[model samples]
Target chain A: MKTVWTQKGFLIPAGALLIAILLPIFASEYALHIAVLVLLYAYLSTAWNVLGGYAGQHSLGHSLFLGIGAYTSTFLFTKIGLTPWVGMWIGALLAGLVGWFVGYLCFRYGLKGPYFALVTIAIAEAMVSLTNNINFIGGAMGLEVKWLGNSPLLMQFESKAGYYYIALVMLVIALWLVYWLSRQRFGYHLIAVRENEDAAEALGVDTLRVKIQASILSAFLTALGGTFFAQYFTYINPRNVFGEGPSIQILLFAIVGGLGTVWGPAVGALVLVPIAELARGWLGGSFAGAHLLLYGTVMVLVMLFMPKGIIGLYESIRQRLKRGSSAPEEERTPA
Target chain B: MSMLTVSNLSRYFGGLAAVVDMSFTVEKGEIVGLIGPNGAGKTTVFNMLSGFIPPTSGEIIYQGRRMNGLKPHQICELGVTRTFQVVQPFPDMTVLENTMIGAYVRHPNTTDAKRKALETLERVDLDAKADKLGRDLTLLELKRLEIGKALASEPDLLLLDEAAAGLKDTEIEDILTLIRQLNREGMTLLIVEHLMKVIMNLSHRIIVLDFGKMIAEGTPQEISQHPAVLEAYLGKDE
Candidate 1:
């Protein structure tokens, strides 16, 4: 009596979404806002997973795309009187182009391993420096959208529910993309390159082209999230967009969830984001930076105790249970 | 007609001449065995030929095209492929996927690549382990997977570096039979092996190297009784 829904294994996600939608009804307004932030990070983490997880390219500079996305949309709306909805695609395209260029330079020069990670960090830092000196979009002071009216057309919402729904849609899209990528031929090539470049090349895979494509796709999706974040918050700053904290948070979600698995980052965000908000709410102003300290400590603990990640730990336990149940039954009727 | 021609190929590491003044021609659709003692620069010769390492001074003409300074992938695209002495299948990939990547060169489409990969796996009799990961395979399976990968590339010239090393006698026989079958199917093969019996059974002609110099070149039967070949292998103990 296997059900179609259960057979597909989509029941978990379906159930989870149902719970998420129903939670805002019983929860406080503050809790809803926290949930929105969690969904946003989860979406971004999943996007990063395309390059960092599937491709095995550790990029510490993903915040560069986020910053570019936020800046592009906000700049377009404030300068040309365009709505953010129209600006989103523009931002995504720009981010993807920039990502391709950066990836090309890194891959062409054979900058790999930790050196590649360092290059990403350098690019992010350089972007921050460049933005600081460039006064085109309010420079170091940051940009704020001053609106006469809170209009849905402007992508400015009066309630947190609108942001929640949007973030939910993004998360769903990111998860689907990750799922599709994991089963695709390009996805297999990325994994092969990740596992062993020499072996992949010997087998006729063009490693550089595959990696660059991964990077471009990751950047485009990440930038879309950035546009949404700017429109939802109605404020954008270089520090907030391209900051080290945002970079760490995205990586932490992916790493804490499961580095290479599709659902790992989403699971990580669901578990960690609310805890972070709760810690901040409980600690208050006197305990400033305590949430960060706690987050860092938990990340370190997760890495040390469960190196394969929370999802990996869950898989190991599941396998053990399966073996235990099946083995005992087989022993009872030994040949 | 020669498919591959090497002339005045030389490589030096500081003061040591690894491969010096070497020249050879591998005729189309022929098996040429390169036999040499340890450190006689046999692997280095293969490396230079396959574009893994550049020769300090040399010319390599493959399929009547200059192949002196091309990358390994480019050389592969030009219908030349080689297997490493150390088996290098992507350990995380299944045996079928490992071969599929090789087949991808000719058939970039997924369906076509998988179909060709299946055919190559069947030829090597590794179709049963198609779903098994490379890391989980036995030593013989790994070696077979390596050959399957090279075969997947659809190469005109296949360079096999010590394909029979570290194998049991029966395993070696299986590989020899597969090589003979491939040769009969019109594939050109250049094999490097230390095993006398396998080389004698497979090679149409043998070239022996000692101290980075060609000591003998003849048919397997002729080389077997050559005093220089015997002296090179046994150090004149006879």
Candidate 2:
């Protein structure tokens, strides 16, 4: 009777999944690729939301985990005969370890607010430089996955549908993880720490430990997405994985959709990715940076008008409607 | 036996002495009142005793153990818990969640913590608003929640910092009755209050502070009659 699919929060996700499954049948190859891109961005934003939105620790360097995951998994798969599936877990572990270290250093030293944001940015830049200079895993040129000829063992398939399905599964897992955490005791503790660290500490909640746990959990999930991306594209580059673009993309979707809400990033990705693809298709040749300009304007408007993001706006309207209907019912009842 | 003892406790903020040479002892199952005018270091004493701000010099013995340098949470774990003057409830959490955090000191398991938290909320008459967000609580409810939180820790020595401040007369009376009940239940309490009637009526013995110094210590009737206490209150420039 209490099936996971029948839960209150699963409705939107279930609908999204149904649409994702059905779209490939009617969509063009270009449209399918856009859909894949949307899934990828959605996954990344949802991963970032765990730490940025739920924990109230705004991270601008989430690509650090993505890069680490991509490189670690790809390196293992190429150097050894290991499958990408096994490498995915390894990458997640490494990323989680690194996140733990970073969290410890930042929280221990009381690096917070804009200063913490700067630290993440600096780390992202540093990771990029480090990856660029490292020669073992293809260095600045990047790594390419060997063609496996539709081998399920290697997680490579000839069809784009394979990639789409994989991305969908990942999106589902990420969404589930966020939802589970948002309802747990750990989530409440994370929110308390986010709202006021001193008060949380005084109340016997280990603020530092909670922050570190959130960071590590967030990194682990984001790293899995990274490995999926590497396998899906069969390519990995420092600019693509560790670059500012991926970081900004993750933060943008999370913010534009609704940072702390369950479906904020998914909704953000769904809205933004299609528009971006359409813009690129129409004016990409003549107007080079037009898509970027449009994105910037849209983001600025979203921030100014709907500070809580689109989902927040939707919720407010829903609440008002419920109140309106309930008021009339109460009036008629004459309590 | 003394539940809490502070000797030669001093705290310096930059060049000024906020609390100096403060020494006191609270017996088990006694209600002791610390009364002072604004900025007389009443809160500083609470802060030092509860390990919020470490004393610049001296020792605090709680249950015959030195507690001067321990962290606030550690001190809380040692059966000493304090409520803030400004009431620092976790604003994003529900009242139950906030209280559960306090209960976590004694009961680490979620079920046990919830059970304890509920019992403590009932003790403070806050069980009705258990599901309400901390931010949505009224001033009276907030104060009750503050006390409820300290109670959740199962403290042997409970410190109250202006728990009755900014309440209606009836609300204050309600809180006073609760405090009396808690005291009657064999809980040791140290209360800081500006209201003379509440302090005089509630405290068996009162300690008065003026200019960060212990100006007087006596029964409530003696403190009211002390010439120096009256001068300290009246001599201040209005």
**Top candidate, metric DockQ:** 1
- Scanning candidate 2 chain B in windows of ten residues, the lowest lDDT window is B229-238
TM-score of chain A of each: 0.94, 0.94
- Encode model 1's per-residue lDDT on A3-122: one tens digit a residue: 545764678888998998787678777888989989999999998888898788899999999988888989999999888788888999999999899899998788888999999988
Deviation in Å, model 2, residue B135 alpha carbon? 3.5
Error of 1 at A88 (Å): 2.5
TM-score of candidate 2 relative to the true fold:
0.91
- Residues B92-155 of candidate 2 have per-residue lDDT tens digits of 6789989988887778777888999999999889998898889999989999999998888888
- Listed for every candidate in order, the interface RMSD values in angstroms are 1.8, 2.1
What value of lDDT does candidate 2 attain over all alpha carbons? Answer: 0.87
DockQ of 1: 0.49
Model 1 clashing residue pairs (backbone): none
